[model samples]
Target: MDLEKPSARRQEPEGCLVVAIRLPVRIVALLVVVPVRMAWDALVVAGRFLNDTVLRPLGRALLWLGRAVFVWPFVGLWRYVLVPLGTGLAWLGNVLLVVPAVWLYRYVLTPSGHACAWLGRGVLAGLAWLYARVLTPIGHALMWVLKGLGAVFAAIGLGVFGALAWLGRYLVVVPAVWVYQWVLAPVGRAVSAVVTGIGVALYWTVRVLFVLPAVGLYRWVLAPVGRVLAVLGREIRDALGHAWRVAGRISLAVGRFLAGLFRWIFVEPVRWVYRTVLTPVGHAVRDAVLRPVADAARSVGRATRQALTAARDSVRQARADVRRMLFGEPRQREAVARREPTGRETRTLGSSTTALTKD
Candidate 1:
């Protein structure tokens, strides 16, 4: 091998010269893209896994904290304190104020409304019933009279027509019959025989062609069809009634189910909440807040009573002092002696003694 040409170098192993020169570029590319590739695949998976493991729980904890911080206090106040207090207040108001008002309306206005409605209904019913009882019968009687007159006229016309028919039969039919018996009978007997034969043939043809077939059709096909139709109609009517009853029952059941659903959705939940959650919380709040308020009120009331008693005593003392200052002392009559009686008074006493001794 010639050492001057680059491909024919025979001293390649001396300085570790390899056939390929891609190792540096590959090492550099790995050094550059390894982090990016890891970020694209493994980092994303690690991020997702970490999110599920740590961040999601942290988010849930934050949500719970938010709910506890914001929602719980109001819920407590609304359910525990405000609801019971409002219920009590509403009960008090309803008992003291609303019930009487509702009773007044019920007893006063409702009866008046009912009376007015009854009066109006009675008036309307009276009018309608009066018409039905009196006017309708009168109208029916008048109509019957008019129909009777019409029938009488129709009978007269029918009787006139019958008389005319009888008169014409006597005037023409007897003459024609007499002529046929005397003059035309002998001449037309042969033709009458031929006509009689023709009539007999036509009669037989009608019986065979139309009457017998009609009777057979009526007996065999039409009668059976009518009977089947009647049975089908009866079955259809019975099925319709049965279906109506079933539909009614289903509707009743559905109504009951809907009522139960409403109770379950609304009433039962509220009852459970009131029983399990609200009742306990309300009792706790009563112990915490209302008891203290009641104690404070009692203390204040005692203080007020003591103050009022002091004031009342002070007023009585002031009134007694005013009475003593306003009223002066008066002397009694027993403290002074009587003046000596005059001679006239002594004479009067003597006269009284004389009268007493006489008595």
Candidate 2:
């Protein structure tokens, strides 16, 4: 049997069909997902850029501010407070350990057989006693040797004193007296005579050679000197007088010129300044400062004078009052004298009364 000719149409496999559907789905999903993934990635990149540009800078600024505010205080607290406290704790722990060790050493090991303090005291006492006992014989021997040396020295000293006394009389005193009388006294007399003779000779020689001749020479020389000096003095005086006349003329001319210049330049303006500015300013300053001071001084002087006068018057018045009070008024002065006793009269009467009473 002949088969019919197969047509050119191809049949789709089931797997291929399924694969095609899945591929479409996957392509669509990928197409959508790619853009979403890209957008997500862009968002992540932008977020990172923003964070790097803005958030990082802000964070750094905040961190710097935090450090500025807190770092020094924290460091100070750590260094000054915490560190010291820790060191103190460590030192206290060490001290606690050492204290007990020292205590144990002092209590137990210092004197292992007895109480340490009493044993130490007793040992010290015994050492002192032994030292004393050892030194005693040495001290006695030293004393005995010193005593012998002293006795020897004393004997030597006594012998020396006796020898010196004898030598003073024999060697020094009599020799000194004999030398004074023989050598010094004769030498003094000879020297005095030689000196007197030389003085007289010199006086006569100077009078003859120097004084008389010098007077003649001076007189002879001074005549010519006086003549020359007089001429020179006259010449100098004439020259000085001419120079003074010239200087005076020149100075007057200069003064006239300067005065003319000053008058041309300054005198009128200066007069105005003196009248307006300088005079007023000087007067104001003087009146404000010096005048007040002068016034105050004058017032003080016047007040002082017045006070002195018042004091004098008060003293005088007081003296007069006292005199009046003591003596009463002038009218009663004679009465007062009469009432008071005279010393001579009272003495005479008392003498008579005493005589009569005695009789």
Candidate 3:
């Protein structure tokens, strides 16, 4: 038929049918929807962010910044500079006041020493007064507050728990304890003792009536059956072993048989035909077909060689005749033959011999 039809169909597998479909519209749909979906998702994210973000303001941010700028500097100054200056002034005053008193025995109540000692005593008295008046009272007040709170909580807990416990004892706990002691405990013990007695009796009955008989049956009957089964299993195993060995031998024999059959049916005949029939037929065909060609080639070669020899002889004869007419020589061929068999003479003699053999 037409070979081009199938090849054309194969090359343009989707040409017209694919083009007729609205492929461009589908491509446009895909391209347009991707960006629209991305834009919609972006809007959703922005709306979610705005839901929380729209309420925050600059006031809280600036409040912390303002504290850092104003309050932190004052804190640093008081801690690093003001505290050190105050401590140094207090130390100088203490040394000026107390040192003179400590050395009063050496000064012997001199006015300057007395004044320094009095100042030191006054400073000490003032410190004691400040501690007694302010710090002691503050500590007492804190202790009183903590003690009052602890006592109040203890009283409340004791009262509420005492009332609830009394109520529970009256309503639920007393009756439950009474019932357990008088009813459930006695009943449970009696039932448990009875269950134990019955279980003991059942255990003895089964051991005496059923278990002993079953054990005796297994010892006498089942054990002998088991021994017989084991003997049968051994016999079956030996039989299977013999069958397996025989199967292996059969497989080997089948493989040997198949090999011999293939040799006899196919391989030997092929070998015989190639050696005895095809070999001689090939030789005979070569003799029949090629020998004439070789003979014709030899004949053509002989004819060419003879013609050349004759041409040469004629030319030589003409030359000799001309020479005789002029200078005279008739023994060219004889002289050539007597001189020696050169390449030209050898080739001519070989051609003559081949021609003679062919004839």
lDDT per model vs. reference:
0.77, 0.76, 0.74
Query: Model 1: residues >4 Å from true position, as ranges?
Result: 1-233, 256-265, 329-359
Please write out the lDDT profile of model 1 over residues 217-336, one tens digit for every residue.
999999988976665564445444444444445555665787799999999999999999999999999999999999999999999999999999999989888877888444455755
The TM-score, computed over Cα atoms with residue i paired to residue i, of candidate 1 is 0.28
lDDT of candidate model 3 versus the reference: 0.74
Separate clash counts for every candidate: 0, 0, 2
Q: Which TM-score value belongs to model 3?
A: 0.34
Q: Which pairs of residues clash in candidate 1, taking residues 3 or more apart in a chain or in different chains?
A: none
Could you give candidate 2's per-residue lDDT for residues 280-323 as a string of tens digits?
A: 99989998999999999999999999999999999999999999
Give the C-alpha miss distance for residue 262 in model 3, angstroms.
5.6
Best by TM-score: 3
Candidate number with the higher TM-score (2 or 3): 3
Error of 1 at 143 (Å): 62
Better of 2 and 3 by lDDT: 2
TM-score of each: 0.28, 0.28, 0.34
